[model samples]
Target chain A: MMLEILTYPDPRLKEPSTTVETFDEELRNFLSNLEETMRAGPGGVGIAAPQVGRFQRIAIVDVSSHKKVTKHHGRLVLINPEITDWDGFEIAREGCMSVPDYTGNVIRATHIKLTAQNENAEIKYFEMEGYEARAVQHELDHLDGLLFLDRLVSRRHDLFQRKTHQKKK
Target chain B: MKNWFMLALVGQDRVGIVAQITDALYRGGCNLGEASMLRLGTSFTMMMMVNTQLDENTLISVIQPTAEKLGLHLHLDQIEGELHPHPEPDVKIVVHGADRAGIVAQVTGELANAGLNILDLETGVGGSDKKPFYFMQIEGNATQGMEALQLALEKLKETLQGNIDINLSPLETFDL
Candidate 1:
């Protein structure tokens, strides 16, 4: 089941999500739907619960399908995710399903060590770098009621409007 | 119905320019839209879209006094058709080299020939007066795709004979 993604200016997208306390069947069910929604989106490699109007610290990431990314953890279901440590800095352009009209250059940590829970409520730790790290950071931001627009390095120099026409892969 | 106009102003760098202009527009019952305000060297420039019930003459009368007091050059033109033109850029091109003439013209000429539409561009000169460096970043849509645009840039770079460095990359976005 694919969940409906809320676009920008939807006040709920700005509302911070609470941590997931119970790891039960309901939580697992929602995670499955979130993964379906992410896969259904055009070029979407990750998604957070808040994007579907659910106020929970849950996100799904799977960058294995991305040709440029060689290092990825396949499909990761992160519940109550937290970045334990981060290092390095780089700027990359980012676009979100919520903010469909524009893309912006954002500075993010190049590497990050994070802790999250799997669908079975097992705590897991992972180290991510490069594009994978960037994707995780982007989804994590949604849990905190943040958007790429908030992290733009420079509004004038870094912000760009997305082209209306889609390019063929 | 809304009357849309493009307003342009340029003047020496000074404080309260925006405050004064906006205040006058507010008093004249004008609503502000998209705006770009920046400083170039010692001068400040502003380009804005304004919507109001006033005609050109009346609009000028409303902003004229503020413009005169600030010693700024002001121009107002009624907008026709689309208020916002040009799509977002799909590619980013960066050029760096020693200060020289024809860099912008030649580079942009190639892009134009390739049918790419330049959406935003900024150029600056740095380093000492003895050995100045020119840097430019351009965001545009490459209708012919990144490969074709990259080839065109490569050809342009060769034409310059290693005098300048040009880097072309796709402006990609991930849905996260």
Candidate 2:
């Protein structure tokens, strides 16, 4: 049962999801279908449970399926995932399946560790870097109702760039 | 449907500009949409997309006084359609080196040659006099990946002799 990927303006994408409390067949079926839906899309590496209209903390990311993911190594099905640590920063442009026709530079931690549950309700741990790290962050945003646009790094010049707009004396 | 208006304001940087403008618009019942405000050197610019039940003439009349009081130039144009995210084919182009002539033209010329369209280009020359620097950020699209245009910039930096550095990344869009 492959689920429909929710696009922007879909209220479901904005509503926050709850944690997955049980590791049962229904959850397994949803996870599997979510994985299928993600794999079937072009340039898709991950999908959150809420994306398919399931308001639960479940997401599947198989970076291995993306042409560029082969350069990295990791595939995950996460339930109630939490980031325990983060380090550094990388700003890169990102597009989302949920929000089409836009891509913006998002700041992501260069390194991160995540604690989550697999389909069996078993706890899984991940320490990853590079594209995989960004994929995880992007999927995690959905669980909390955040799109990359929410993390846009525009106007960074407010911090250090010379103020060319200063009034002349 | 409500009418859309684009308001552009540029003037010397100062406090209270946003407060005054927004307060007036809020009082007039204007719905503000996507907007960007930036300070460049001694100048400040703000561009906003707004929706309201007012006509362009009414908008200018309402905003013009604020512009006059602040000594800012204003341009307001009525537009149609709702504002949404835009994904143009572009790259994040960063060029930095010592200040000099023709840096912009040389780089933009290269981009033009590669068939790219620039959406936003910001150039600045600032730093200590002993080590003045030129910095630029060009948001543009060249029908190819960063690698494809590598030679265009590498050659320019080689010829310009500013010890120029260039970084390019594809402006990727995820269309579902």
Candidate 3:
């Protein structure tokens, strides 16, 4: 099924949407739509409910194919996921589907162990690092209406335009 | 909300660097954002993005003194409006090697010589007793009438003398 895509500055992009208490068909279907929408977004690595015009506590993350996965590849469907543990301070460039056309560096935990329910309603936990951790954190921030711009290190440098030349040897 | 700038302070490592600089930012009505403070041998390096609600045009003037007071070489830049379009739009290059002296200088110098504007760069240096590696991603926009980024690639390779690797590609945005 087709999913709705929310563009930048949409209020629905803010305000952590309500939680998905029931692991019902509707919730599963919404999750599917989120995945589809994420795949369709340019440079999209993850997407939360708020980004897809949904207010449910759900997000689909597939950092598997990203440059810095550093782990196995697969999609993660977080249903009411809570960050149970986080450690270390890292400054990484982050962007969002909700706030398109902008990227900024934000300080986040280098490592994160999160807990959430899978499609089967079974609680699952995962430990992620590097880009995976950063991607998950970015998606989770949407659950609270927080954009990477809001957490940007400073306003001086918005994510600069993508460089056209490769680095010199 | 206050617009912020990232201040990178690099100098001989010493005590109270963070405190003193932060105090100045606070007094100047600037808000501190994410920062990484560390000691690289004898030198201490701090990179922080700071924000302030002060008028856009007046931000640099106010922060100039704070930067001087802290003895920091400051770089204040803005991310707004349309960027100047590059006259030449189809050139790219990549750099990777072991971390050592003159890496940034040597690479940036090539871009300068070619009259190419660097659009983006990501450099990572990592090593230990067991392994050593350096990675750099550079995207460049060439000047008009200069489609031969390959020429610059050869020059860069010769300049590095086999210590590094260079790859050339067409202009494209990874958006990562």
Instruction: Give the winner by lDDT.
Output: 1
> Which is better, 1 or 3, measured by lDDT?
1
All candidates: interface RMSD: 2.9, 3.5, 5.7
lDDT of 1 by residue, A1-169 (tens): 9899999999999999998889888887888888888998876698999999999999999999988889888989999999999999877778888887667778899999999999888999999998899999999999999999988887454435456797889
- Order of models, best TM-score first: 1, 2, 3
Candidate 3 deviant stretches above 4 angstroms: A155-169, B1-107, B113-116, B119-176
**TM-score (all chains, Cα) for each model:** 0.88, 0.82, 0.53
Give the chain B TM-score achieved by candidate 3.
Answer: 0.49
All candidates: CA RMSD in angstroms?
A: 7.7, 5.2, 10.9
- Cα lDDT computed for each candidate against the true fold: 0.88, 0.80, 0.70
After superposition, candidate 1 runs with Cα above 4 Å error: A155-169, B80-86
Best by DockQ: 1
Worst 10 residues of 2 chain A by lDDT: A65-74
DockQ of every model listed? 0.42, 0.38, 0.10
lDDT of 1 by residue, B145-165 (tens): 787787788889789999999
lDDT of 2 by residue, A16-72 (tens): 889888888877777778888888776668888888888888877767655554445
* DockQ preference between candidates 1 and 2, better one: 1
